[model samples]
Target: MRVLVTGATGHVGRHVVAQLAEAGHDVLAMTRNPATAAFPASVEVVRGDLLAPASVPVEGVERMYLFPEPRTATEVVARAKSAGVTRIVTLSSGAVTGGFDTDFQLPVEQAVEASGLEYTHVRPGDFASNTERLWARMIRADRVVRYAQPDAPSLAIHDGDIAAVAVAALTEDGHTGRWYDLTGPELLTRREQVAAIGDALGEPVRFEEVSPVRAREILERQGGWGAENAGFLLGFDDYSATGPSFDDVDWSATLVPSPTVEEVLGRPARTYAQWALDNVAAFR
Candidate 1:
């Protein structure tokens, strides 16, 4: 299959491209800046931006791995359909649980569904790598502070696992019209997550809980927390107080059986400890 992957340079997209290449699929790695795309030489890199659908050269594409939030998802899907693209595997978010009416993901999902292409929606939970954004500060200060609900638990799947699933869905058959919820094997609270990171680093990592109001203020000062994100975080916190039910959702019957990290990477998935050990230098 000739597969075109958008956001090919992103955290998960990069891994997806690698896995696709390893599986012997012809991969077209799409990026806005081809020069900056770090992918294997076997990948045919292309200059394309999802924001500008007209700029994409969609010839000879049999399948695609799409990332959500492109400016023109509908247009891009339409073009891919016209170009004889048979399958589309999208990297969608768990936020769609709130429904398309309230979530930004709905539009992308609608576009893909309407595209008339055989599609598999990969809806993954919180990414374990999202911790990297805060690990540096935690390592330096020896403390991790956030507006995390102490009682709420999340099964944060590793990005590599998510990518592996995407590759399977794109390359294998019998996944069409399916929505897979990819999550980690176990659920852990925010406090427990911090402890896990500390265990990985061979040190104590303290987690300080902040009130939602304080968290919002801090995020606002940082200039990156918008109202929607703030609401989502706070809502998630509230939901956690009752225990996270989403973590219990069944996924045993996926077309591609969930592969353990060790199985997918031929080594253990990078645990919080392993990640901390490997990236401790970034903390300095």
Candidate 2:
């Protein structure tokens, strides 16, 4: 089977490419910068960006691991179908399932569903890798994580685990038409997550509580994903409400770990502690 994986250099996409290659699939990794993209020697690297669907070459591709870019999703799915791609596994978000997301990933999902292609939606909750963006620099600088909601909990799924599910959907049967809501094996508080990172580094990492407003301000100043989503994550803004007002969600219901990863792959999903240990170098 020839599989084309877009966003093939991302945290999840890279794993999807590597896993597919390891599974003996003829993998085509689509990236915006093929020169910097790294994959197994057996994998083919091609230049493409979902923002410009025309750059993606789907010729002879039987399946795809699509990274959502709503701007061109309809066109991208059309091209894939025209080229005879039979199946597609999307890297969607849990927010879609929670009914809090409409503009971003939902549109992409709609496009794929309308394409008449076999589709599987991988809706993963908070990524374990997000810690690198939110706290890695702070840990490296002072071994401390200062943020709001220290007791707030999350089931932060591993990027590789997400890729594993996507790979199974792409290469195997019985996964089509499934919408998988995935999570890590355990739920941990913000403070506990910081502690896990410290444990991984063989040191004590302090968690200092701050006001959510203060934290949002700090994240905004830092820029990147932290800045972009500071309001949404910190609960200052709600997508459904479209403005300021706290308590739009019940964290207790949303933070529990899901068994879907283990159910789909026949193995335990990675824990937050294991994820920290696996990427300890980032904190160091």
Candidate 3:
């Protein structure tokens, strides 16, 4: 099967492309800049911008791994359908499962579902890769990580694990119209996560608990995902900046570990410790 993977250069998209190529499928990796993106030689790279849906190369593509771009999702799905694409596996958010996501990934899932094509929504919770983005700089500069919620539990799933589930949905039958909620095999606190990274590095990393306001300020200055999501993660703001704060909800139920990843891939989900080891160089 020939699969077109949009956002092919992104964190999860890269894995999806690699896995598909390794599985001997024809993989079309769509990226904004094909010149810089790297993939297996067996995978073909193409230029496509989700914001501009017309550029997506769907010719002879039977399935797609869609990256959520809510503004153009309907048009993108329509074009894929018209191009004879039979199935779609969307990279959705676990927020939709908790009803907190309406403006973003939800729309993409809706668009694909409405297209009359076989569709599966892969909704993953806190990504283990986020730790690399949020703490790698701090750890590299000075083996220390400061956070507002040192005890906050997270089921940070590996990006590779998320892609594995997505690949299964795209290549296998009986996954159509299914929504798979993925998470790590176990729950780890903020301090524990830092400890895991420290273990991977063979060095002791200190975890300092800071006030939410101070943490937010640091995150704002750190930039990237840290800056963009600082307010919401710190309980001062939300996705729209108008919704209720993060503290308003009881997140205990959401913290429980889910077996969906293991159930889908027929193996145990990767742990944060393994993820930390895999990405130890970034911290170093």
Cα RMSD, each candidate = 5.5, 1.8, 1.4
What tens digits encode model 1's per-residue C-alpha lDDT throughout 249-271? 45333323234444434544444
What TM-scores do the predictions have?
A: 0.78, 0.95, 0.96
lDDT of 3 by residue, 87-185 (tens): 999999888888778788988999999999999999999999988888888899999998888988899999999999999999999899899999999
lDDT of model 1 at position 4: 91
Q: Backbone collision count in every prediction?
A: 1, 0, 0
Identify the superior model by TM-score, candidate 2 or candidate 3.
3
Top candidate when judged by lDDT against the true structure: 3
- Rank by lDDT, highest first: 3, 2, 1
C-alpha root-mean-square deviation, candidate 2? 1.8
TM-score of 2: 0.95
Off by over 4 Å in 1: 97-103, 141-143, 223-228, 236-284
